[model samples]
Target: MFRLALKSLLNRRGTVLLTVFTIALSTALLVGVERVRSEARSSFASTLSGTDLIVGARAGTVQLLLYSVFRLGEPTANVSWATYQQIAAAPAVAWTVPISLGDSHRGYRVLGTTGAYFEHYRFGNRQPLAFAHGEPFAGVYEAVLGSEVAAKLGYSLGDDIVIAHGIGRVSFSNHDDKPFRIAGILAPTGTPVDRTVHVPLAAIEAIHLDWQSGTRLPGRGISAEQALTHDLTPRSITAFLVGLKSRVATFQLQRQINEYRGEALSAILPGVALQQLWSLTGVAENALRLVAACVVIVGILGMSTALLTTLNERRREMAILRSVGARPRTILGLLCLEAMSLTLAGIVLGVLLLYAILAAVRGYAASQFGLFLGLGLPTAAELYALAAIFSAGLVAGMVPAWLGYRRSLSDGLAVRT
Candidate 1:
């Protein structure tokens, strides 16, 4: 039966091939979307794996995560440097790394942080930050470039780069006088960190010393040397990441920060905040899955349509098999085998194509889009999705197979023009 089905499909290779290609494309779409969706969530979850709580001015948890960790938006307010220090001094707090934003260098965000950032910040299974070249910023006038920033801007250690006053790419008020020398370049982290420029928190204060209202004060010149002599301590910071001495005290510390009397503050568990983000994004993810599923259905239906259309043309063939004492059930099984074979072939091709495309674009996706796609075996979820597609194909083919079984040998062998 399998051999006969194979020969029959070979005889109509044109239509069969087209049907297989259609199914292959849809299967690829379904599995590809699933892979990207899963990877994106994994990436987002791992973006701050080592951090316990992210503390910032009172705002929505997701909003705080967006601006603090992802650099997606502006902070609602800043935490006083005094408040940050107080929190750092908490007994339960093991360490805290303050982050000050509101500056940019040529479209990339400038992150004002301390050397502890490199030591504490982590991604992808508690991986520590490593330097691709040079070391962390040491001096007030020095800067560290993320891997992406260095590569994209063609900057290296000892190169002087000016910091802009605001987040805009084109700033009318530039701190050209106090340009920073590149002190370090961090390895690619495949997170928002890659797109950031790291500098001491004091660098943020030093650049804004001669500026007011988001512009450089005219006729008021403070040379880099002169600015260094003056106070460069930051008055406030956008947010801070906190690590606890004991995991059991996380909730206690979070509650304390939320109820602090000096100012309104919010502290969130990074894991919980990430789950909130997933909840918000789940709708769109499901919509994409639904669309992929619809495409798969269309492909399966097209295959069934093709099979039904060919039943008429193969009537004489069916009659010949029936005359040879082949049971109607045998004819049905042949059609069913053909459908399963086509589906299996399509699935194999689609998986191969998916991995091929992923291998070719994996680096590009990581560097350009911050999307990390592993070129590993298909995940269990992906395997399940493929199995579901194959099963649907089997059920779809049964429609045509049933109709073929219902056909009488006399009806097929009847004389027709």
Candidate 2:
């Protein structure tokens, strides 16, 4: 019976092929969206794997995360160096990495941090930052480039690059005199770290010495050498990553930072903040998934249309089968089986296409956008989605199957013109 059904489908190979392609594309789109969304979440969650809390000036948790972690926006205010030191000195705090921003090299963000950043920072399952070529910055006028920065700008160790006055790509006022040598190039982490430029905290202070009130002082220049001679201690820092001595102390430390009388500050659990951010953006994610679901429904509807339209052409074939004692029930089952088969084929094809495309572009996406897509098997949710599509296909076939059953009964063994 299955062989006969396959033969009948092959006879209408043109329409069958077209329907298969339509369903295949829809399946690919649906599965691809889910895959990308899952990977994006994973990549984002892994960005600060080992950090216990992120402390920043009083602002929205999402805002602080964007500036401190993703380099998305400028901080509203800075935590005073005194405040930072106090937080670091807390008994519950095991370690802290001070971060100072507001500087830029070309268009990439310049992150002023201590050597402790490289030592304590982790991503993607507590993975430490590995050097691609050289060690971390040691000298005052030295900088370490992220993988993306080095690859995009064609920079290498010992290369000299100047910092811009602001974060803009086209800044008129460049710190031309304080050129920094590329001290190191970090291996790709498939996170925001891949896009940042790391320099000593002193470098951030050194570049701003000649400037007063966000503008260069008129006719008073402080060369890099002269600036280094002065106390380059930062008075304020944008934020700091904190690791607690024990997991039990997390809430205690967070409460202490939030209520500190020294300065208005906020300390957030990174995991909690990330979940909140995801929830805020859940609407868009759901919208994308809904659109993909609609596409799958349209594809199933198309299969139904193709089968119903072809029923009239198959009337004579149905009559011949009835003459040979084929039951009306058999005819109905055949149509249903054909629809399910087509859907299954399309799903298999779509999955293959999805992975093939991912395998081809995974490296580029990681290097350019820091989005790492694994070539792993589909998750449980994806498998369930595919099963749902298959079930929908069967349900969609019921309409054409009913029609075929009714016609076979009415036109039993009759020759139709």
- Candidate 1 residue runs with Cα over 4 Å from true position: none
In terms of lDDT, the poorest run of 10 residues in model 1 is 367-376
**Model 2 residue 156 CA deviation in Å:** 1.6
TM-score of each: 0.97, 0.95
Query: Cα deviation in Å at residue 211, candidate 1?
Result: 0.8
* Candidate 1, 204-229: lDDT as tens digits: 88888888888778899888889899
Question: Over all chains combined, what TM-score does candidate 1 have?
Answer: 0.97
Identify the leading candidate in terms of TM-score.
Answer: 1
Q: Give each model's clash number.
A: 0, 0
Per-residue lDDT for 326 in model 1? 94
Worst 10 residues of 2 by lDDT: 408-417
